[model samples]
Target chain A: MKARVHITLKNGVLDPQGRAIANALHSLGFDKVGDVRQGKFIEIDLKESDKAKAKSEVDQMCAKLLANTVIENYSVDLVE
Target chain B: MKSAIVVFPGSNREKDAEAALTEITGTPPVMVWHRDTELPKVDLVLVPGGFSYGDYLRCGAIAAHSPILREVKARADQGMAVLGICNGFQIITEAGLLPGVLQQNAGLKFVCRNVNLRVETSQSLFTSRYEKGQVLSIPVAHHEGNYYADEKTLDELESRDQVAFRYCAPDGSLDPSHNPNGSQRAIAGVFNRTKNVLGLMPHPENAIRELLGSTDGRGLFKAMAEALAA
Candidate 1:
Protein backbone atom coordinates (compact mmCIF):
# COMPACT_ATOMS: atom_id res chain seq x y z
CA MET A 1 0.00 0.00 0.00
CA LYS A 2 1.02 3.58 -0.62
CA ALA A 3 -0.21 6.97 0.49
CA ARG A 4 0.30 10.32 -1.13
CA VAL A 5 -0.18 13.61 0.66
CA HIS A 6 -0.32 17.14 -0.65
CA ILE A 7 0.38 20.03 1.70
CA THR A 8 -0.37 23.65 0.90
CA LEU A 9 -0.46 26.99 2.60
CA LYS A 10 -3.95 27.88 3.71
CA ASN A 11 -5.87 30.58 1.86
CA GLY A 12 -5.19 34.16 2.99
CA VAL A 13 -1.68 33.19 4.09
CA LEU A 14 0.95 35.16 2.19
CA ASP A 15 2.94 32.94 -0.20
CA PRO A 16 6.17 34.73 -0.92
CA GLN A 17 7.61 31.70 -2.69
CA GLY A 18 4.52 31.52 -4.88
CA ARG A 19 4.77 35.21 -5.67
CA ALA A 20 8.41 34.79 -6.57
CA ILE A 21 7.51 32.01 -8.99
CA ALA A 22 4.80 34.18 -10.52
CA ASN A 23 7.24 37.03 -11.02
CA ALA A 24 9.73 34.67 -12.58
CA LEU A 25 7.07 33.33 -14.94
CA HIS A 26 6.14 36.84 -15.99
CA SER A 27 9.77 37.64 -16.60
CA LEU A 28 10.03 34.65 -18.91
CA GLY A 29 7.01 35.85 -20.99
CA PHE A 30 4.37 33.59 -19.42
CA ASP A 31 2.04 36.57 -19.15
CA LYS A 32 -1.14 34.54 -18.73
CA VAL A 33 -0.06 33.15 -15.35
CA GLY A 34 -1.57 35.45 -12.76
CA ASP A 35 -0.65 33.41 -9.68
CA VAL A 36 1.50 30.48 -8.63
CA ARG A 37 1.19 28.96 -5.15
CA GLN A 38 3.78 26.43 -4.05
CA GLY A 39 2.99 23.22 -2.17
CA LYS A 40 4.52 19.89 -1.17
CA PHE A 41 3.68 16.40 -2.35
CA ILE A 42 4.84 13.51 -0.16
CA GLU A 43 4.59 9.82 -1.01
CA ILE A 44 4.62 7.22 1.71
CA ASP A 45 4.95 3.46 1.26
CA LEU A 46 2.89 1.72 3.87
CA LYS A 47 3.13 -1.83 5.16
CA GLU A 48 -0.49 -1.93 6.17
CA SER A 49 -2.54 -4.05 3.81
CA ASP A 50 -5.94 -2.54 4.64
CA LYS A 51 -6.52 0.43 2.36
CA ALA A 52 -9.10 2.00 4.69
CA LYS A 53 -6.89 1.53 7.72
CA ALA A 54 -3.87 2.92 5.90
CA LYS A 55 -5.81 6.00 4.83
CA SER A 56 -6.93 6.62 8.40
CA GLU A 57 -3.37 6.27 9.69
CA VAL A 58 -2.09 8.61 7.02
CA ASP A 59 -4.72 11.14 7.95
CA GLN A 60 -3.48 11.00 11.51
CA MET A 61 0.06 11.51 10.26
CA CYS A 62 -1.02 14.53 8.25
CA ALA A 63 -2.82 16.06 11.17
CA LYS A 64 -0.11 15.38 13.71
CA LEU A 65 3.21 15.80 11.90
CA LEU A 66 3.00 16.07 8.11
CA ALA A 67 0.93 19.23 7.99
CA ASN A 68 0.91 22.23 10.25
CA THR A 69 -2.76 23.17 10.50
CA VAL A 70 -1.86 26.63 11.73
CA ILE A 71 -0.61 27.57 8.24
CA GLU A 72 -0.83 24.52 6.00
CA ASN A 73 -3.61 22.14 4.98
CA TYR A 74 -3.15 18.58 3.67
CA SER A 75 -4.97 15.97 1.62
CA VAL A 76 -4.15 12.29 1.59
CA ASP A 77 -4.69 9.70 -1.14
CA LEU A 78 -4.33 5.96 -0.69
CA VAL A 79 -3.30 3.57 -3.42
CA GLU A 80 -2.93 -0.19 -3.47
CA MET B 1 18.60 32.81 40.53
CA LYS B 2 18.43 29.21 39.35
CA SER B 3 17.76 28.88 35.63
CA ALA B 4 17.38 25.95 33.23
CA ILE B 5 18.17 25.92 29.52
CA VAL B 6 16.43 23.18 27.54
CA VAL B 7 18.75 21.60 24.99
CA PHE B 8 17.32 19.81 22.00
CA PRO B 9 19.65 17.66 19.89
CA GLY B 10 20.31 20.41 17.37
CA SER B 11 20.32 23.29 19.82
CA ASN B 12 23.61 25.10 19.29
CA ARG B 13 22.82 28.19 21.33
CA GLU B 14 22.36 26.44 24.66
CA LYS B 15 25.89 27.28 25.75
CA ASP B 16 25.43 30.89 24.84
CA ALA B 17 22.21 31.10 26.77
CA GLU B 18 23.81 29.21 29.67
CA ALA B 19 26.75 31.60 29.60
CA ALA B 20 24.52 34.68 29.57
CA LEU B 21 22.38 33.40 32.44
CA THR B 22 25.40 32.40 34.47
CA GLU B 23 26.99 35.81 33.95
CA ILE B 24 23.92 37.60 35.19
CA THR B 25 22.60 35.12 37.74
CA GLY B 26 26.10 34.17 38.98
CA THR B 27 25.20 30.48 38.73
CA PRO B 28 25.34 28.08 35.81
CA PRO B 29 22.08 26.90 34.31
CA VAL B 30 21.13 23.25 34.36
CA MET B 31 21.19 21.71 30.88
CA VAL B 32 17.95 19.83 30.44
CA TRP B 33 17.80 17.35 27.57
CA HIS B 34 14.75 17.10 25.36
CA ARG B 35 14.12 13.46 26.22
CA ASP B 36 13.86 14.11 29.94
CA THR B 37 10.31 14.35 31.21
CA GLU B 38 11.42 15.97 34.44
CA LEU B 39 13.12 19.32 34.94
CA PRO B 40 14.95 20.71 37.94
CA LYS B 41 13.03 23.29 39.88
CA VAL B 42 14.19 26.68 38.64
CA ASP B 43 13.04 30.25 38.61
CA LEU B 44 13.30 30.56 34.80
CA VAL B 45 13.40 28.40 31.66
CA LEU B 46 15.33 29.47 28.59
CA VAL B 47 14.75 27.87 25.19
CA PRO B 48 17.76 28.66 23.04
CA GLY B 49 17.97 28.76 19.23
CA GLY B 50 19.16 26.18 16.69
CA PHE B 51 17.92 23.97 13.86
CA SER B 52 16.23 21.41 16.07
CA TYR B 53 15.57 18.03 14.46
CA GLY B 54 17.42 19.55 11.53
CA ASP B 55 14.31 21.71 11.03
CA TYR B 56 12.47 18.74 9.52
CA LEU B 57 8.75 18.88 8.72
CA ARG B 58 8.78 22.51 9.84
CA CYS B 59 11.00 24.63 11.94
CA GLY B 60 10.36 23.90 15.62
CA ALA B 61 7.42 21.65 14.85
CA ILE B 62 9.16 18.43 15.82
CA ALA B 63 10.84 19.98 18.81
CA ALA B 64 7.57 21.23 20.23
CA HIS B 65 6.41 17.69 20.90
CA SER B 66 9.57 16.70 22.74
CA PRO B 67 9.00 15.27 26.21
CA ILE B 68 10.87 18.09 27.90
CA LEU B 69 8.62 20.77 26.42
CA ARG B 70 5.64 18.99 27.91
CA GLU B 71 7.02 19.75 31.35
CA VAL B 72 8.11 23.22 30.23
CA LYS B 73 4.61 24.02 28.99
CA ALA B 74 3.06 22.79 32.22
CA ARG B 75 5.33 25.00 34.28
CA ALA B 76 4.73 27.96 31.97
CA ASP B 77 1.00 27.57 32.52
CA GLN B 78 1.71 27.90 36.22
CA GLY B 79 3.37 31.28 35.48
CA MET B 80 6.98 30.22 35.01
CA ALA B 81 8.96 32.79 33.04
CA VAL B 82 9.88 31.15 29.69
CA LEU B 83 12.03 32.87 27.10
CA GLY B 84 12.24 31.47 23.58
CA ILE B 85 14.68 32.94 21.13
CA CYS B 86 14.74 32.49 17.33
CA ASN B 87 14.20 28.77 16.76
CA GLY B 88 13.08 28.57 20.36
CA PHE B 89 10.38 31.09 19.49
CA GLN B 90 9.16 28.86 16.69
CA ILE B 91 9.00 25.85 19.02
CA ILE B 92 6.79 27.60 21.58
CA THR B 93 4.41 28.68 18.85
CA GLU B 94 4.22 25.16 17.45
CA ALA B 95 3.77 23.91 21.01
CA GLY B 96 0.86 26.37 21.33
CA LEU B 97 2.59 27.98 24.26
CA LEU B 98 2.68 31.18 22.22
CA PRO B 99 0.32 32.52 19.59
CA GLY B 100 1.22 33.05 15.91
CA VAL B 101 3.38 31.15 13.42
CA LEU B 102 6.75 32.15 12.06
CA GLN B 103 6.82 31.65 8.32
CA GLN B 104 9.58 31.93 5.78
CA ASN B 105 11.20 35.30 5.33
CA ALA B 106 9.37 37.53 2.86
CA GLY B 107 12.43 37.79 0.63
CA LEU B 108 13.15 34.04 1.00
CA LYS B 109 16.65 34.77 2.20
CA PHE B 110 18.57 33.93 5.32
CA VAL B 111 19.07 37.14 7.29
CA CYS B 112 21.85 37.61 9.82
CA ARG B 113 22.58 41.09 11.10
CA ASN B 114 22.11 43.65 13.80
CA VAL B 115 18.66 45.20 13.94
CA ASN B 116 17.20 48.03 15.94
CA LEU B 117 14.14 47.14 17.98
CA ARG B 118 11.85 49.54 19.77
CA VAL B 119 10.86 48.44 23.26
CA GLU B 120 7.10 48.66 23.49
CA THR B 121 6.58 47.93 27.20
CA SER B 122 8.63 47.78 30.39
CA GLN B 123 5.99 46.24 32.59
CA SER B 124 6.77 42.60 31.78
CA LEU B 125 9.46 40.55 33.52
CA PHE B 126 11.50 40.41 30.31
CA THR B 127 11.78 44.10 29.47
CA SER B 128 11.42 45.79 32.84
CA ARG B 129 15.08 46.85 32.85
CA TYR B 130 14.66 48.96 29.72
CA GLU B 131 12.54 52.05 29.43
CA LYS B 132 9.56 52.09 27.18
CA GLY B 133 10.32 53.15 23.61
CA GLN B 134 14.03 52.47 23.95
CA VAL B 135 15.70 51.34 20.72
CA LEU B 136 17.77 48.19 21.22
CA SER B 137 20.46 47.05 18.81
CA ILE B 138 20.29 43.25 18.71
CA PRO B 139 21.50 40.62 16.22
CA VAL B 140 18.99 38.37 14.50
CA ALA B 141 19.96 35.29 12.51
CA HIS B 142 17.26 33.20 10.96
CA HIS B 143 15.70 32.19 7.66
CA GLU B 144 12.09 32.01 8.82
CA GLY B 145 11.67 34.93 11.18
CA ASN B 146 8.58 36.46 9.58
CA TYR B 147 5.78 36.42 12.16
CA TYR B 148 2.12 35.85 11.29
CA ALA B 149 -1.07 35.71 13.31
CA ASP B 150 -4.79 36.06 12.68
CA GLU B 151 -6.26 39.55 12.77
CA LYS B 152 -8.08 38.94 16.03
CA THR B 153 -4.97 37.69 17.79
CA LEU B 154 -3.00 40.62 16.45
CA ASP B 155 -5.60 43.01 17.78
CA GLU B 156 -5.52 41.39 21.20
CA LEU B 157 -1.74 41.48 21.24
CA GLU B 158 -1.77 45.19 20.57
CA SER B 159 -4.64 46.03 22.89
CA ARG B 160 -3.19 44.12 25.84
CA ASP B 161 0.39 45.28 25.39
CA GLN B 162 1.70 41.78 24.63
CA VAL B 163 4.02 43.11 21.99
CA ALA B 164 7.46 43.30 23.53
CA PHE B 165 9.55 44.59 20.62
CA ARG B 166 9.23 45.91 17.08
CA TYR B 167 11.80 46.55 14.40
CA CYS B 168 12.65 50.22 14.03
CA ALA B 169 15.12 52.66 12.58
CA PRO B 170 17.93 54.16 14.60
CA ASP B 171 15.88 57.31 15.15
CA GLY B 172 13.05 55.13 16.55
CA SER B 173 10.90 55.28 13.41
CA LEU B 174 8.90 52.29 12.18
CA ASP B 175 10.34 51.87 8.73
CA PRO B 176 9.56 48.97 6.44
CA SER B 177 13.13 48.86 5.21
CA HIS B 178 14.32 48.28 8.74
CA ASN B 179 12.14 45.17 8.99
CA PRO B 180 14.61 42.53 7.83
CA ASN B 181 12.14 39.65 7.70
CA GLY B 182 8.80 41.38 6.99
CA SER B 183 7.18 40.39 10.27
CA GLN B 184 3.63 41.65 10.73
CA ARG B 185 3.58 45.16 12.21
CA ALA B 186 7.36 44.86 12.35
CA ILE B 187 7.01 42.59 15.40
CA ALA B 188 10.34 41.33 16.68
CA GLY B 189 9.11 39.88 19.96
CA VAL B 190 5.84 39.09 21.75
CA PHE B 191 4.64 38.03 25.19
CA ASN B 192 1.95 35.54 26.13
CA ARG B 193 -1.42 36.66 27.47
CA THR B 194 -0.30 36.09 31.05
CA LYS B 195 2.97 37.87 30.19
CA ASN B 196 5.00 34.90 31.46
CA VAL B 197 6.17 33.54 28.11
CA LEU B 198 8.11 35.58 25.56
CA GLY B 199 9.18 34.54 22.06
CA LEU B 200 11.46 36.64 19.90
CA MET B 201 13.51 36.24 16.72
CA PRO B 202 16.51 38.23 17.86
CA HIS B 203 19.40 36.63 19.85
CA PRO B 204 19.69 38.70 22.98
CA GLU B 205 22.20 36.25 24.42
CA ASN B 206 24.55 36.97 21.54
CA ALA B 207 24.65 40.65 22.45
CA ILE B 208 25.10 40.62 26.22
CA ARG B 209 28.62 42.00 26.29
CA GLU B 210 30.07 45.35 25.21
CA LEU B 211 33.02 43.69 23.45
CA LEU B 212 30.53 41.67 21.38
CA GLY B 213 29.53 44.92 19.58
CA SER B 214 26.74 45.93 21.98
CA THR B 215 25.58 45.25 25.49
CA ASP B 216 22.02 46.38 24.78
CA GLY B 217 20.80 42.83 25.24
CA ARG B 218 22.02 42.70 28.85
CA GLY B 219 19.00 44.54 30.15
CA LEU B 220 16.70 41.71 29.15
CA PHE B 221 18.72 39.08 31.02
CA LYS B 222 19.23 41.47 33.90
CA ALA B 223 15.52 42.06 34.00
CA MET B 224 14.91 38.32 34.24
CA ALA B 225 17.53 37.93 36.96
CA GLU B 226 16.23 40.87 38.97
CA ALA B 227 12.68 39.70 38.64
CA LEU B 228 13.64 36.20 39.79
CA ALA B 229 15.54 37.61 42.76
CA ALA B 230 12.62 39.76 43.77
Candidate 2:
Protein backbone atom coordinates (compact mmCIF):
# COMPACT_ATOMS: atom_id res chain seq x y z
CA MET A 1 0.00 0.00 0.00
CA LYS A 2 1.00 3.59 -0.57
CA ALA A 3 -0.20 6.98 0.51
CA ARG A 4 0.12 10.26 -1.33
CA VAL A 5 -0.19 13.58 0.41
CA HIS A 6 -0.52 17.09 -0.98
CA ILE A 7 0.21 20.01 1.30
CA THR A 8 -0.54 23.58 0.35
CA LEU A 9 -0.57 26.92 2.03
CA LYS A 10 -4.06 28.01 2.88
CA ASN A 11 -5.76 30.72 0.87
CA GLY A 12 -5.10 34.24 2.21
CA VAL A 13 -1.71 33.17 3.55
CA LEU A 14 0.96 35.12 1.71
CA ASP A 15 2.97 32.83 -0.57
CA PRO A 16 5.98 34.87 -1.50
CA GLN A 17 7.76 31.94 -3.10
CA GLY A 18 4.74 31.26 -5.28
CA ARG A 19 4.55 34.92 -6.19
CA ALA A 20 8.24 34.93 -7.10
CA ILE A 21 7.68 31.90 -9.28
CA ALA A 22 4.84 33.68 -11.02
CA ASN A 23 7.02 36.70 -11.61
CA ALA A 24 9.73 34.50 -13.07
CA LEU A 25 7.22 32.88 -15.37
CA HIS A 26 6.00 36.30 -16.50
CA SER A 27 9.56 37.41 -17.18
CA LEU A 28 10.03 34.27 -19.25
CA GLY A 29 7.05 35.33 -21.46
CA PHE A 30 4.51 32.95 -19.93
CA ASP A 31 1.91 35.70 -19.76
CA LYS A 32 -0.92 33.29 -19.04
CA VAL A 33 0.34 32.54 -15.54
CA GLY A 34 -1.68 34.15 -12.75
CA ASP A 35 -1.97 33.72 -8.99
CA VAL A 36 0.43 30.80 -8.73
CA ARG A 37 0.59 28.82 -5.50
CA GLN A 38 3.27 26.29 -4.48
CA GLY A 39 2.98 23.22 -2.25
CA LYS A 40 4.59 19.90 -1.30
CA PHE A 41 3.80 16.45 -2.55
CA ILE A 42 4.88 13.46 -0.46
CA GLU A 43 4.50 9.77 -1.15
CA ILE A 44 4.80 7.17 1.57
CA ASP A 45 4.93 3.40 1.39
CA LEU A 46 2.96 1.61 4.08
CA LYS A 47 2.80 -2.00 5.24
CA GLU A 48 -0.84 -1.81 6.20
CA SER A 49 -3.10 -3.45 3.69
CA ASP A 50 -6.40 -2.17 5.05
CA LYS A 51 -7.49 0.93 3.08
CA ALA A 52 -9.40 2.39 6.05
CA LYS A 53 -6.46 1.89 8.41
CA ALA A 54 -3.98 3.28 5.93
CA LYS A 55 -6.09 6.40 5.36
CA SER A 56 -6.42 6.97 9.08
CA GLU A 57 -2.69 6.53 9.66
CA VAL A 58 -1.84 8.89 6.83
CA ASP A 59 -4.35 11.41 8.14
CA GLN A 60 -2.63 11.31 11.48
CA MET A 61 0.72 11.87 9.82
CA CYS A 62 -0.60 14.93 8.00
CA ALA A 63 -2.06 16.42 11.13
CA LYS A 64 0.94 15.69 13.32
CA LEU A 65 3.89 16.37 11.03
CA LEU A 66 3.24 16.74 7.34
CA ALA A 67 1.04 19.84 7.47
CA ASN A 68 0.97 22.76 9.86
CA THR A 69 -2.72 23.40 10.29
CA VAL A 70 -2.07 27.02 11.15
CA ILE A 71 -1.02 27.92 7.62
CA GLU A 72 -1.45 24.88 5.40
CA ASN A 73 -4.05 22.38 4.25
CA TYR A 74 -3.47 18.75 3.35
CA SER A 75 -5.19 15.98 1.39
CA VAL A 76 -4.37 12.30 1.40
CA ASP A 77 -4.89 9.54 -1.17
CA LEU A 78 -4.23 5.89 -0.60
CA VAL A 79 -3.49 3.26 -3.24
CA GLU A 80 -3.45 -0.50 -2.81
CA MET B 1 19.97 31.52 36.70
CA LYS B 2 20.19 27.84 35.81
CA SER B 3 19.55 27.29 32.13
CA ALA B 4 19.72 24.71 29.38
CA ILE B 5 20.24 24.99 25.64
CA VAL B 6 18.61 22.41 23.38
CA VAL B 7 21.04 21.39 20.66
CA PHE B 8 19.65 19.90 17.46
CA PRO B 9 22.04 18.33 15.00
CA GLY B 10 22.03 21.38 12.73
CA SER B 11 21.72 24.02 15.45
CA ASN B 12 24.69 26.39 15.23
CA ARG B 13 23.91 29.07 17.81
CA GLU B 14 23.85 26.96 20.99
CA LYS B 15 27.32 28.22 21.87
CA ASP B 16 26.27 31.84 21.43
CA ALA B 17 23.28 31.25 23.67
CA GLU B 18 25.39 29.45 26.23
CA ALA B 19 27.92 32.28 26.23
CA ALA B 20 25.29 34.97 26.65
CA LEU B 21 23.55 33.15 29.47
CA THR B 22 26.82 32.41 31.25
CA GLU B 23 28.00 36.01 30.99
CA ILE B 24 24.76 37.30 32.42
CA THR B 25 24.16 34.63 35.07
CA GLY B 26 27.73 33.70 36.02
CA THR B 27 26.83 30.08 35.31
CA PRO B 28 27.11 28.06 32.15
CA PRO B 29 23.92 26.53 30.80
CA VAL B 30 23.71 22.78 30.25
CA MET B 31 23.62 21.57 26.68
CA VAL B 32 20.83 19.07 26.00
CA TRP B 33 20.93 17.06 22.80
CA HIS B 34 17.84 16.61 20.67
CA ARG B 35 17.86 12.83 21.05
CA ASP B 36 17.67 13.00 24.83
CA THR B 37 14.35 12.26 26.44
CA GLU B 38 15.07 14.10 29.68
CA LEU B 39 16.21 17.62 30.46
CA PRO B 40 18.15 18.64 33.54
CA LYS B 41 16.21 20.85 35.93
CA VAL B 42 16.76 24.45 34.92
CA ASP B 43 15.12 27.82 35.19
CA LEU B 44 15.19 28.42 31.46
CA VAL B 45 15.50 26.43 28.26
CA LEU B 46 16.66 28.08 25.04
CA VAL B 47 16.17 26.85 21.52
CA PRO B 48 18.85 28.61 19.57
CA GLY B 49 18.99 29.44 15.86
CA GLY B 50 20.24 27.22 13.04
CA PHE B 51 19.20 25.19 10.01
CA SER B 52 17.71 22.42 12.17
CA TYR B 53 17.17 19.18 10.29
CA GLY B 54 18.56 21.13 7.35
CA ASP B 55 15.27 23.06 7.32
CA TYR B 56 13.81 20.02 5.62
CA LEU B 57 10.04 19.77 5.04
CA ARG B 58 9.86 23.29 6.48
CA CYS B 59 11.97 25.50 8.63
CA GLY B 60 11.84 24.05 12.16
CA ALA B 61 9.21 21.56 11.11
CA ILE B 62 11.34 18.44 11.48
CA ALA B 63 13.15 19.58 14.58
CA ALA B 64 9.84 20.33 16.24
CA HIS B 65 9.18 16.61 16.46
CA SER B 66 12.58 15.68 17.84
CA PRO B 67 12.62 13.78 21.14
CA ILE B 68 13.94 16.57 23.31
CA LEU B 69 11.23 18.94 22.12
CA ARG B 70 8.68 16.73 23.86
CA GLU B 71 10.37 17.45 27.16
CA VAL B 72 10.69 21.13 26.33
CA LYS B 73 7.00 21.35 25.55
CA ALA B 74 6.05 19.54 28.72
CA ARG B 75 8.15 21.78 30.91
CA ALA B 76 6.81 24.83 29.10
CA ASP B 77 3.27 23.75 29.92
CA GLN B 78 4.22 23.58 33.58
CA GLY B 79 5.27 27.27 33.59
CA MET B 80 8.95 26.84 32.77
CA ALA B 81 10.43 29.73 30.80
CA VAL B 82 11.30 28.84 27.21
CA LEU B 83 13.04 31.09 24.75
CA GLY B 84 13.15 30.30 21.08
CA ILE B 85 15.31 32.39 18.78
CA CYS B 86 15.26 32.44 14.96
CA ASN B 87 14.84 28.84 13.83
CA GLY B 88 13.92 28.12 17.41
CA PHE B 89 10.98 30.44 17.03
CA GLN B 90 9.90 28.51 13.97
CA ILE B 91 10.26 25.24 15.92
CA ILE B 92 8.17 26.35 18.87
CA THR B 93 5.45 27.71 16.63
CA GLU B 94 5.47 24.50 14.61
CA ALA B 95 5.29 22.61 17.88
CA GLY B 96 2.12 24.60 18.70
CA LEU B 97 3.66 26.22 21.76
CA LEU B 98 3.12 29.58 20.05
CA PRO B 99 0.70 30.98 17.57
CA GLY B 100 1.50 31.99 13.95
CA VAL B 101 4.10 30.75 11.49
CA LEU B 102 7.23 32.20 9.94
CA GLN B 103 7.14 32.21 6.16
CA GLN B 104 9.53 33.18 3.40
CA ASN B 105 10.75 36.73 3.38
CA ALA B 106 8.52 38.97 1.32
CA GLY B 107 11.53 40.34 -0.56
CA LEU B 108 12.53 36.78 -1.47
CA LYS B 109 16.04 37.21 -0.10
CA PHE B 110 17.88 36.28 3.05
CA VAL B 111 18.09 39.26 5.42
CA CYS B 112 21.04 39.43 7.79
CA ARG B 113 21.54 42.74 9.57
CA ASN B 114 20.69 44.85 12.57
CA VAL B 115 17.11 46.01 12.96
CA ASN B 116 15.70 48.29 15.58
CA LEU B 117 13.29 46.55 17.97
CA ARG B 118 11.01 48.38 20.34
CA VAL B 119 10.33 46.60 23.59
CA GLU B 120 6.57 46.36 23.57
CA THR B 121 6.21 45.69 27.28
CA SER B 122 8.36 45.24 30.36
CA GLN B 123 5.82 43.19 32.30
CA SER B 124 7.15 39.78 31.28
CA LEU B 125 10.22 38.03 32.73
CA PHE B 126 12.04 38.35 29.41
CA THR B 127 11.77 42.15 29.21
CA SER B 128 11.71 43.26 32.85
CA ARG B 129 15.17 44.84 32.63
CA TYR B 130 14.17 46.99 29.68
CA GLU B 131 11.66 49.77 29.67
CA LYS B 132 8.61 49.69 27.54
CA GLY B 133 9.13 51.53 24.26
CA GLN B 134 12.91 51.24 24.55
CA VAL B 135 14.53 50.63 21.18
CA LEU B 136 17.27 48.03 20.85
CA SER B 137 19.37 47.17 17.82
CA ILE B 138 19.26 43.41 17.25
CA PRO B 139 20.51 41.27 14.40
CA VAL B 140 18.06 39.03 12.52
CA ALA B 141 19.41 36.54 9.99
CA HIS B 142 16.79 34.36 8.40
CA HIS B 143 15.24 33.80 5.00
CA GLU B 144 11.84 32.90 6.50
CA GLY B 145 11.35 35.38 9.29
CA ASN B 146 8.11 36.89 8.05
CA TYR B 147 5.46 36.14 10.70
CA TYR B 148 1.95 35.23 9.66
CA ALA B 149 -1.31 34.55 11.51
CA ASP B 150 -5.01 34.89 10.98
CA GLU B 151 -6.75 38.14 11.86
CA LYS B 152 -8.47 36.70 14.92
CA THR B 153 -5.25 35.29 16.38
CA LEU B 154 -3.45 38.56 15.75
CA ASP B 155 -6.17 40.45 17.54
CA GLU B 156 -6.06 38.02 20.45
CA LEU B 157 -2.31 38.37 20.79
CA GLU B 158 -2.57 42.16 20.70
CA SER B 159 -5.39 42.35 23.22
CA ARG B 160 -3.62 39.95 25.55
CA ASP B 161 -0.38 41.91 25.43
CA GLN B 162 1.42 38.91 24.00
CA VAL B 163 3.43 41.00 21.57
CA ALA B 164 6.90 41.23 23.12
CA PHE B 165 8.68 43.40 20.57
CA ARG B 166 8.09 45.20 17.32
CA TYR B 167 10.51 46.27 14.62
CA CYS B 168 10.80 49.99 14.49
CA ALA B 169 12.91 52.90 13.35
CA PRO B 170 15.77 54.25 15.45
CA ASP B 171 13.41 56.64 17.16
CA GLY B 172 11.06 53.75 18.03
CA SER B 173 8.44 54.54 15.44
CA LEU B 174 6.47 51.68 13.84
CA ASP B 175 7.24 52.53 10.28
CA PRO B 176 6.60 49.84 7.68
CA SER B 177 9.92 50.60 6.02
CA HIS B 178 11.77 49.48 9.14
CA ASN B 179 10.27 46.01 9.12
CA PRO B 180 13.03 43.66 7.90
CA ASN B 181 11.02 40.58 6.94
CA GLY B 182 7.45 41.84 6.59
CA SER B 183 6.22 40.48 9.92
CA GLN B 184 2.63 41.30 10.71
CA ARG B 185 2.15 44.64 12.45
CA ALA B 186 5.94 44.83 12.40
CA ILE B 187 6.13 42.31 15.22
CA ALA B 188 9.68 41.19 15.96
CA GLY B 189 9.02 39.01 19.01
CA VAL B 190 6.01 37.42 20.67
CA PHE B 191 5.16 35.87 24.02
CA ASN B 192 2.97 32.88 24.62
CA ARG B 193 -0.41 33.58 26.15
CA THR B 194 0.97 32.86 29.62
CA LYS B 195 4.00 35.05 28.83
CA ASN B 196 6.42 32.39 30.14
CA VAL B 197 7.47 31.31 26.64
CA LEU B 198 9.05 33.75 24.18
CA GLY B 199 9.95 33.20 20.56
CA LEU B 200 11.65 35.90 18.53
CA MET B 201 13.45 36.08 15.21
CA PRO B 202 16.24 38.46 16.25
CA HIS B 203 19.36 36.89 17.79
CA PRO B 204 19.74 38.59 21.16
CA GLU B 205 22.39 36.04 22.14
CA ASN B 206 24.56 37.36 19.32
CA ALA B 207 24.34 40.96 20.55
CA ILE B 208 25.01 40.52 24.27
CA ARG B 209 28.41 42.24 24.50
CA GLU B 210 29.58 45.74 23.61
CA LEU B 211 32.28 44.25 21.39
CA LEU B 212 29.44 42.58 19.46
CA GLY B 213 28.46 46.17 18.47
CA SER B 214 25.50 46.39 20.87
CA THR B 215 24.81 45.50 24.48
CA ASP B 216 21.11 46.18 24.06
CA GLY B 217 20.42 42.45 23.99
CA ARG B 218 22.02 41.97 27.39
CA GLY B 219 18.95 43.50 28.98
CA LEU B 220 16.88 40.52 27.92
CA PHE B 221 19.22 37.97 29.52
CA LYS B 222 19.58 40.13 32.62
CA ALA B 223 15.85 40.38 32.91
CA MET B 224 15.43 36.63 32.62
CA ALA B 225 18.19 35.86 35.10
CA GLU B 226 16.83 38.28 37.68
CA ALA B 227 13.29 37.02 37.34
CA LEU B 228 14.30 33.37 37.56
CA ALA B 229 16.60 34.03 40.49
CA ALA B 230 13.80 35.72 42.39
Candidate with best DockQ = 2
**Steric clash count of candidate 1:** 0
Candidate 1 lDDT tens digits, B117-148: 99999999999999999999999999999999
Could you estimate the TM-score for every candidate? 0.95, 0.98
Tens digit of per-residue lDDT, candidate 2, span A1-80: 99999999999999888999999999999999999999999999999999999999999999999998989999998888
How many Å off is the CA of B81 in candidate 2?
0.7
lDDT of 1 by residue, A1-80 (tens): 98999999999999999999999999999999997899999999999999888989999998877888878999988888
Per-residue lDDT for B87 in model 2? Answer: 97
Q: List the residue pairs that clash in candidate 2.
A: none
| Tens-digit per-residue lDDT, B108-216, candidate 2 | 8899999999999999999999999999999999999999999999999999999999999999998989999889899888999999999999999989878878989
lDDT score for residue B58 of model 1? 89
Q: After superposition, how far is residue B116 of candidate 1 from its true place, in Å?
A: 0.6
